[model samples]
Target: MSTDNKVPEIRSKGFSGEWAEEILGDVAEIKTGPFGSTLHAKAYVEDGHAIITTEHFKSGELPVDKKNIPQVSEDDYLRLKAYLLKVGDIVFSRVGSVDINALVTNKQEGWLFSGRVLRVRSGKIIDSEYLHHELSTSRVKKSVVSRAVGQTMPSINTEILKITPIHFPLDTTEQTTIGNYFQKIDALINQHQQKHDNLSNIKKAMLEKMFPKQGETIPEIRFKGFSGEWKNLTLGDLGSVAMNKRIFKHQTTISGEIPFFKIGTFGKQADAFISKNLFDEYKAKYPYPVAGDLLLSASGSIGRVVEYKGEEQYFQDSNIVWLKHDGKIDNAFLKVFYSMVKWSGLEGSTIQRLYNKNILDTEISTPERQEQTAIGNYFQKLDNLINQHQQQITKLNNIKQACLSKMFV
Candidate 1:
């Protein structure tokens, strides 16, 4: 669309605020980041100052405990003082993963700017917080990114940013009002996120207490005490543990009668994949998983177990293992147990990878059937509550995104 035609005409409909267009006049100065190579942690060594980067800019706030934030010496600070970010200045990412902008709040007071970010300073024409929102809006991000030029790593230089059009209310009071309005919403979102994190930590602690360590068993419940000790069993002793047989490459078809699962699908709580209608008949000859069977990843993210609750599904040749436990083992208990073990000592190509032999040889202290049921039920209830809170967080975030899209342009 042409720039003149695509410009968002100021709407006087429901808003009491006055809309105005400022030609991004010369009142504001744009500063590109320096070419300093100071590592993030080095930026804050002895009596060091905080540094802001694309990673530090979170939902409207800069996190203080950032891992890679660079520190600067007094001499370096003096040399770069002109480019140092001040409170209310807006810092944005110009290189990779562009469009992350955050207003420098009091939390970042005295922090130095990093080479990977650009700083925008306006002399009273715009509220930094408001401008931060404007710059980060999806409309502006899309328009500005389209103007970026690069083949390997894209970048928006300072000269390009100087001409980036910004819309604002003509009155400063209106600008502050709108900025504060969104700030409150952002704060609420942060609060909810922190609560979610706390609940997750609590769940982790509970899991440690509920499960027995190696060579340990649950003490007899005073109410329903049992005389027998819990058994130490290897996974191989529990059931038929086998990796899926690979289908011949030539025989494989895109759409088949059976749904093939990759490690990604298993990571999600899904159990089945429908054939895409392109698979050859011979490729569907492997053993299919039935409902209630426990599916585990043997390689690449080993020991992630999910109970198959779907109608039917076929496993892929990826690092996944299927365990069809006999009636003696409760799948629910194993699922929770696998998650609690922390999967330590299991090595893979990446941090999430796991090996089948290591997991199979790892011993688990299995309680009697009755005790297993109690432990599973307790953790399940807690997990269900966490899921509900997570759903709420998702809904709130979606609402925020929608509001931002409509309110901006």
Candidate 2:
């Protein structure tokens, strides 16, 4: 098919039809919440009609507990009952850099929208689910924010919202099909996300139980073959730290062939780079990270680690700390043990930092080489599974975004 017409550039198979252009005022009734002063902090109470605000902008079923959201009296609710939300009504936050909206389900019926929100009732023209999905897409959201006015915090008025364009298929059945498809996708995304969270919690619990706590020589749990007290060792005993060479900002280039890595760029692509001459000169003389070594970030997110993967890169000085092993430790074993470590002297400190000397001086517990290898291998497999699940969720989300962009006009 040719691409010049109003037909979407891409869409789901078996439906080559195009969407029709419509305006928001033609298909929906738009209105803002009560006046700013009408709903104040003093209006909140222990129990009554729940006042939905930007905080509860998440569209879907509300939680059973409600988590102690502020409420209002019956009289106040009756007076502002005109602003009460019902099934199929979508509400948006009037202020904020990004446009935030929530679809009011049957469960959210009878809840009043606070002054900061704008409620849009799709009047028999557009499907509520489809409209919400359309508004959420980057295409429409950027348009919405572009019209917002402010120096620091951009905001939209109801006039700009009313004239906002809406484009979809003329057929209501087609609208429902698009809406239902996305609704199911959202549910699937939520399911995978919950599984990812559960797996992470399991790993954290295992890290706690399988390792020895402070002042204890033996772990609470161990592998099948291991049966004895763990060994005591300071970090210095495991390996010595190799510090990076001092490279000034002027020596680095924004666009260079050699990748110069800092603590910020560990595990990510390098934004800064050094000349080939500089890298080769430093690689031989200075104490630097090499293959089979673990890179420790000593600032910002202190103690974060990433292993050197034989990539061609030069490290930043003082910011990154690397371990030069002495054949007394396994890299995998050090990684797992580091995850369970609780750094001291960081409390109430303005700038959180872990100097190389302090990390080297910290005491740790360890098991025999065989047991350490087994435990490390097991967790590595578990981590691989976690990454797989998380990657699947990300892939699904990307599919949803691609569909939304092509399925709508």
The candidate that achieves the highest TM-score relative to the unseen native structure: 2
True-vs-predicted CA distance for residue 69, candidate 1, Å: 3.9
What does candidate 2's lDDT look like per residue over 130-168, in tens digits? 898888777677788888888687777688888777677
User: Each model's TM-score, in the order given?
Assistant: 0.73, 0.81
Model 1, CA-based lDDT: 0.67
Residue pairs clashing in model 2 are: none
For model 1, state the Cα shift of residue 144 in Å.
3.0
Q: 318 in model 2: Cα distance from truth in Å?
A: 2.7
Tens-place lDDT per residue, model 1, 1-409, is 1235333333334454334555443546788776655444445565555566666774546775535666667777777777776888888777766666777777777777777788888768788767777777787777678877787877877877777777776566656766786788777777777777888898787776666555577642312554466788877677666556664545444655566676776645444444444333323655556667677876666667777776444566646776656666776777787786655566545646556556666677778888777777777777777787778778777876776665655
